[model samples]
Target: MKIFENCHLFHYPFEKVSAAHWQKYPNEYATHVVAVDTLDRKVLPDSQTLYTERLITCRQGVPRWILKLVDGAQECYIREVSYMDLKSRTLTLLSSNMTFCDRLRVHETVTYSPHHELNATVFRQEARIEALACMKRLANIVEQWSVDRISQKASIGKLGFENVLKQINLSVFHQLPVPSPDANS
Candidate 1:
């Protein structure tokens, strides 16, 4: 088993950051994420929290040797669940791989909360890799590689969220406007 963790500050308030997260993916920084499908989404009975489930398909960027081990398929599916609390200004996400479960399992959890001091939003991510290989050595290698890959993905996701935030006017989220491609132009 291997573990990965990351924490970062987004220069936006919790509401803006949470909205950007919901609108994340299908953006410029997420080329690796090929497709996203919503399985379920609904506002909780209390009307303050939203629960969502989505399946995202991404292109795997592993070594050639690893690809060989994965039947040479370049894509994988991940199941994600998210809870967004409007009153508390918090968002929690949990995700795990749907494919390659027997040989490798990657589970990730993320939280977004307000940063009082910075007046921004703090993002925290943690991931664990379980590689059930016959040989201990191979399992260790795969686990390490999975951690490295997840770390890289987290960085990309941050950039993607930042880009999305830049495109929108943070004051309003209900409109769900698309960021202008020519904002700088």
Candidate 2:
């Protein structure tokens, strides 16, 4: 099976919830920023900017997934992608969803600069690799539980476990060096 599929797992009508309401849940927001630095280094970094209004939040609860569109140039905070909530103890690619708030219109617009295209490519590849690593680690943990016949708790153990993985990835991603512009030019 393909690791990622493009689909709308949930239908949240905008009439029920407005963008203003969704903006409150910025803590659950995640974004991938792609850029090319001076040294021809491509940087695709994922981050949750709580202080910045650049994220889209869920109107009712925390979003399960956020879809970020990363092209060579122009990064836009598009919409919240919805996913299916399986409530499974183990994290599976099938159980995630990205839901967008009703009021926000989905548009196709690239807002980044073309000058840093190379850096953007590198960033995206690195970030994706890091995310995959985290997912693999979780899969390994789940496999261990299965082998031990341990019952996983959806609320506590699984979520907590995933959070730990995410923290580790973030820490490592932050430490990556940004290339100087002169080197690329």
Candidate 3:
């Protein structure tokens, strides 16, 4: 088993970052992310939190050596669940691999919140990788490879999200004018 953790600061407000996260897919930098399907979404009874569950399909090619072990599968499926709390200005995401259950598994947690002493948002990510005991000789190699791949993806993913934030005017989320009740009359 191997653990990887990283933290970064986005020079944007928490609200902006949180809103952009939903629209991050289809960005050029994250082309590996092929599809995103929302399985479920709901606002909690508290009225301050929104919960979402999604399945993400990623088109990734692994090393040839690893391919032989997993029967040449090139697509990865991930199950992601997220919680966004409006009152706390925080967004938390939990994601895990759904493919190759017998060979390996990667579970990740990511959070976005306001910085303590700055006007920016803080992004933190942690991934736990486990190579199943079945691959006694290749376990170490698999774990290390997963860590490296995840690190690279993290950088690209951040860049993609930054682009998303730039293209969308986040303030518009709150600034949209409400139509008059009698406008249709």
Which candidate wins on lDDT? 3
Q: Whose TM-score is greatest here?
A: 3
lDDT of 1 by residue, 1-69 (tens): 889999999988888888888678789878988989999999999679999999999996779988877
Q: Where is model 2 poorest over a 10-residue stretch in terms of lDDT?
A: 121-130
After superposition, the stretches of candidate 2 with alpha carbons farther than 4 Å from their true spots are 1-155
Ranking by TM-score: 3, 1, 2
Instruction: Give the residue spans of candidate 1 off by over 4 A.
Output: 170-185
Tens digit of per-residue lDDT, candidate 2, span 136-175: 5444433333223212221232334234444544666899
Error of 1 at 87 (Å): 3.2
User: How does each model score on TM-score?
Assistant: 0.86, 0.19, 0.89
For candidate 3, lDDT tens digit of each residue in 1-185? 99999999999889888988998899999888899999999999957999999999998878899888888998989999999989888999999999886899999999999998998999999999999989978899999999999999888888888879877765566688889999989
* CA shift of 162, model 1, Å: 0.9
For candidate 1, the per-residue lDDT at 117 reads: 88
Error of 2 at 160 (Å): 0.4
The model with the greater TM-score, 2 or 3, is: 3
The alpha-carbon lDDT assigned to residue 35 of candidate 1 equals: 89
